[model samples]
Target: MALRTYDEYIESLKAMRPNIYKFDELIEDVTTHPATRNTVVGHGHSFKLSSEPEYKDIFTTTSHLTDEPISRYLSVIQNREDMWANSRLKRRMFQLSGTCTGGRCVGWTSLNSMYATTYDIDQELGTDYHQRLRAWLKDAQRRDITIAGALTDPKGDRTKTPSQQDDPDMNLRIIERRKDGIVVRGAKVMICGVAAANEIFILPGSAYREADKDYALSFVIPRDIENLTIVETRHPSDKREHEEGFDIPVSEGGITQAYLFFEDVFIPNERVFMAGEYKFTKQAVFNFISAYRAAIGGCVAGQGDIKIGAAMLVARANGLHTKVFKDKIIQMQINNETTFGIGIAAAALGKEHPSGTWLCDMTLANVNKVHVATLPYETSRLAQDIAGGIGETGCMPSWKDFQSSRYGHLIEKYLKASSSAESRTRAARLVEWLTIGAGVPGCMHGGGSPDGAKLMIRAFGDLESKVEIARRLAGISEEIPEPGGR
Candidate 1:
């Protein structure tokens, strides 16, 4: 079967025994553990969506290679419409989950990037990397497997190149190339959804020169492979999961980050898509980021929808849903719509690559990312302003306290405002979750930090044209170009 049911996906995850750690303790069953179970459930929603009639068109697509129906998460973008559908699917998934859906989108992004870059590499150097990747992707589609994309390396010294570093292993590299395969040793930090994935796709996070050839590699490996360890990173309010009667609204659908270590892990020759192709490193990374950042614009705007809804709820509960607060809500809508508009523009303006995969417009994608880095914060600030004192009051009384026979009446009396105490308390919890807990920081640096988007904007934007326009307007030059021309 090309597509798997939700139950089948969960069962597949249960069959593989991965090495995972949380707080120095081994997680015997990631699918059942509190720290990871929600993420798996969130991921499973994608499978469910694909099977449903309403979402089938967006979530399932025909595989170009095999001519079978496969999840869109595993299919390559074949045209501009596919790109637009991809962004809309991401936004819908985020709105449904109320958090990032682990790493499914990351896998989709990396697959398209590899398809485009490897085709170029093979055409130029007469290599078979594209064919190898195509074979692997077809198998992955048939199995409907979840693949986590690992991009960031644990660079020990930011100022030093991989070769210049005192410890060469700090950046993942080929320590030994055997006849059948290669041995890789190093670590990747800020990895998303490794514990729940069936496999991981590794790519160089930054561009590299010839001297960094060893570090400029890309490949795929199974999560349960030997010599690989995954440690889940701790986040703020993570302990709330263990506390009874502490209903965290935002975290109901959990997300994850981890540190992945590969110590002399052997990757078979067939799985090695790119090995020592340093010159193509930049293209691979840029291709991935351009698409991923556009996705961020859509998903983050979905999150902005959540923030705006919470703000409106709080204002109504506080008996302050007047023109002033209504205007704030409108402003939040403006920011949210702006980001979503950019994402659609990026997708609509995408161009096809030689490899038959569509690539997003770089300038618009960077602009989308830059807006994502800043607009969400302002949305959160407006949410807090509308939330008023309740936003700063911290978490509400525990469910236990609200249920206690002795204190229940007192809480019900004091907490009640323009509405029931339960409504106000839950609204406050949601605001806290979106503003200070996980939502704000995630928006500010999810795809990449704001400064990173700024650098990309500078690189992709055409400043020379703007200068020419200014000079021509001032009659400094006789020539004036046509509209939309340089």
Candidate 2:
């Protein structure tokens, strides 16, 4: 696939078969449908930026398979610089689009995760999964299509494993293994950006035992594949999605999560990277999270940067100098850099796999994930605190109400602050959206939960070594017992 221009990107999406739905309505055209259009526009900007002289370096990379330039979204991360660039690109995307571009980022990380995983599987089992992945990625780079990733399943019981669940379809599983392909059934819930994606990369939701082999599946397929149905999930900004004007900040860009129901959807063998490979599921998921969580630091930092700007803008609109909130703004900056710095540290401490793919340090990456889960919300709170009531409360009149012919003049006159009523309204709306509306990304639980990340942190922690060092410093050889006296 050749590199697509912004127009080409729109056209490409326009060509896909309509399979997305929102509230029981069939979306015939994702390019213009309000429910899907913003996401498409947000992802489309990546294509536009890839060709720009200023952003080309971070947006495009040489495809290892084809020796041709491809969207960084379509390239594999092979080194520290590549990983750093990935983080930078994610940050820039949020800086510009002001939301999650899951149509690209998660899918990009999925393919990269599989790049290392498939290699390891093939080496140990003499499987052809790696070769197939390389071939698929080469074709993908050629097509340069947007691919979304799906990992969350409509798991019925949090405590039960897939095989133990009352309903087997609780987790996506291989229903039938045909000579040509495999048939899958079940659903991936709360997936991001299916409407804007041409194809989707699916991975096992979690590690599985042999009994759950059917659930240990990985593959890619067309988003509009036969027997597949997509339902756009509801969010806090549902009513304003179609609203025109500054009521919805970054109107051309948006966030969407979807639920995908697959009814015996067939994925061809070449597109199947893992099938019934229960043994490799842990590493596969582990690999994906390290990259995803690390890069999410940049995602939140970029949006955090916007939070800083919006707070300042609101202060300006109220005729107050930004320096008045210097301490709060500085705290926001600290939160942003802490998350970003931890991600960079993870990338820097990584080691390359035998497959030639680089993996972020698990401990540092998970720690950053914890930071992403908590710090951004604090930054947002600070932004809202500095914004005063109008920006934080969402009490402003509708953009339409303000523009009405009968009372437009009166509304404008009273709404005016130190600045023009229009400017103040727009700035307040921007702040409201960033802190509470669609502009918010999956900061707290996007890739995974903070609790989950902490579990990983505990897994990777070396507490015994630290205890030994402490003992040496204190010159105490005697064992110290805990409250439980283990």
Candidate 3:
């Protein structure tokens, strides 16, 4: 089977039912709709890249299931090598797209995480979920579809669990289990990249108690499946998506989030990987973050790469040499590599799961997650610091205004720096867009919150042994405790 080209991909999305909406208006064609088109176009770049000889390896891989040349987006991370490839692919995607290409990144991780989880489920519960997943994956590879992974649930109150909530639908739940399939109801909010996807991969939002079994659900369904309504979430860049200006550096690239309401959606048994398996919910979530958090280092680093380039361009636009901000640029480079190196370390140090999937080192991956949450902002700050006020602030005239008859010439003439008016303004706009616009990704909480990663750090780390090692090195054999504890 052949992989999808960029045009074929767009046509496929166009053929889907109109279930996605933005600004209370139905998006008939995602490829042309202002709200969704940019993201779709951004993701489509990978389709073109997959055909190129140099990038073919980065974007295309043989599916282990069928041994067919498929999109790397469809490849499973079977070993440390595959995991490293996945990380590099993510960084390259961000480098080219200049934004989050969640259509494949998260969904790829979701499938891989489920690969391990379903194996455990089948071993203990004697279910055929692993087989079901294999069948679905085989078909998915054949189609070369774009999948957006959905994991976050809008829990109404923090203190209450899913079962304790007055609204049981606070977390997505299985409303009923028919012989042929299951019925699901509830919303997955703030899900990234649904606007650019052909399908949605659903995973349990979090660990759940047996009493909350209804909420312990996972499945895959067409994005436009009946009873599914997608509403693109709001962002500071919403207006900029439609703006006629240098505000959006790349008109074909942007990022999106959505609220997916599954109003009693029916997913066939073959597509259901986990249903009412509350005991394995924690395992499923663990499997997910292990990969998601680690690779996110690449995501931020890619954007940081762009930030550095834009900042330098702005400096030259102002007639300043690169040496003027050498220290700042060096600091930005350090920030990018820190998170990136930590992620690669996690991948290299990982152990293979029983399911033949490579799981990242929990301690190092969480450590990267913490860096992902904090370092990108400092990088952004340095880029802005180097770009000057015009590049950092969205205060310049719009592209339309810059072309207006009345004051266009005056505006253009004053906007000129050491570079031409157009070049100077364009560089400024790019820096602004990257640092503060849609180019900014969910660094602090893309996969999960940093606090959650810290908790995992505590769980996976050997702190007691570290303390013992410290005691021996200090030549203090007796137990020396903290102020209040032994």
Candidate 4:
């Protein structure tokens, strides 16, 4: 059934048939499981927001192929306005979901990359990859499916390539080819929403060499495919939540990343977007980054809004909302706005690619990601600072204490916020949930590491032109015959 509401999406996950493993055992119900439920809730919020009238323009779009209304996540940006709209939509979705929306951006990025790179591949290799991709995307929209993108391969050793890994299955690769389809093996790690996703859109993590051609595989498969298994990573707080219920300091956060195993799984040719297209991998990566990096600015900033608000509320509860705390709040606002500002700048400065869709300004897009890698860390640091010692020491008192007639009055008396323990506890829980709970570290690393942002800055920054500018300023222009050289 096409998902029109958050309820529909949740119901869809409840009905999914998949070989999903959490720890060592099979998970019968991912939709209701503690480990997967929060992530699914986050995903549901994303879908729910799109239907809100105020956000409809940003979150929903007319598909270029079918002209039917589809989630912005499924649509390719056909114009500059579409680019800006998507950035804004992503921010709202992330804000509604708190921090991580369980890799929805990854899926969106995959779609953008496939659209751009497929067109280029068809142009260069006379392949129909672009046509096939569009057809698949159209179907995905018609079905209103949720896709989890599998991009990060488990690099068994940082020193080696996929084919050179000690265990070839450490990195996902194509195993065999049949006339109708291909079989694949190996695994994709740190895959978000694998259990909740209807389909897994698989792609190589990096460019490949001729010897590594078999490792250069890309395709789409149902999450419930027979031979595919998802072993979900356990969140640091998962055990506590199951044992203690909402009494755990932080009850809601991004759940876990799952490692998806493809054990000789067959993917029909129609589902294969790119296979052994080594050169196109780089193009695909860049195309995805061009749009996705810009998107990070929006979502992270939105998350910052939540963090900042929580921090201020906590500080107020703890009687620490001083002028200094106010200033920190201002700083948080600046960081949040600046991050979002870059996303808008990237989108506003977008250019249409030769493939007929718009491409965000690469320089601004990289700048957006660079800010995303840093600003949220600063925001979290300040949040922790305001939270203070009570944030660490506070806990939910037993419900029995409140339920007892004799202790009930005393519990209420002691639990009040100003004089109210409940208020203080709630504040602390909010701080704990966001800072160390599940949001901060993931925000820093989810899109990419800090070093990745620096690398992008170096690549996009034109040092050669700066050097030429310096030479001209020093009266050393070649037109003037510098140092008597012709």
lDDT of 1 by residue, 132-218 (tens): 999999999999999888775888888898889899988999898888888999999887767668889988878999999989889
Question: Backbone clash tally for model 3?
Answer: 0
Model 3 / residue 324 / CA error / Å? 0.7
Sort order, lDDT high to low: 2, 3, 1, 4
TM agreement with the true structure for every prediction: 0.94, 0.97, 0.97, 0.91
> Tens-digit lDDT track for model 3 on 186-237?
9988988888999999898889999989988889999999999999988667
Q: Model 1: clashing residue pairs?
A: none
* lDDT values for all models: 0.82, 0.89, 0.88, 0.75
Q: Give the C-alpha lDDT of model 3.
A: 0.88
Model 1 whole-model lDDT (C-alpha atoms): 0.82
Candidate with better TM-score, 1 vs 4:
1
Give the poorly placed runs of model 3, Cα more than 4 Å off.
Answer: 241-249, 480-486
Clashing pairs in 4: 415-420, 415-421, 415-422, 416-420, 416-421, 417-420
Q: Write the per-residue lDDT of candidate 4 for residues 1-486, one digit (tens) a residue.
A: 233687777777777785888768888887777777777766766677777788778778888887788887778887778877776876776666665665566787787778888898889999888888888998988878788887748778978987788788777788898888788888777877676677888777877888788877778788888898889887756644243423443333364688887789999988988888888887777777777788778777877887887777777776654576788889989998888888888878888888777787778888888788888888888888887754542355544555568787786676565536666666666676677766664556665666776777787787667878888899885643346652
**What is the TM-score (0 to 1) of candidate 3?**
0.97
Lowest-scoring 10 consecutive residues by lDDT in candidate 1? 241-250
lDDT of 4: 0.75
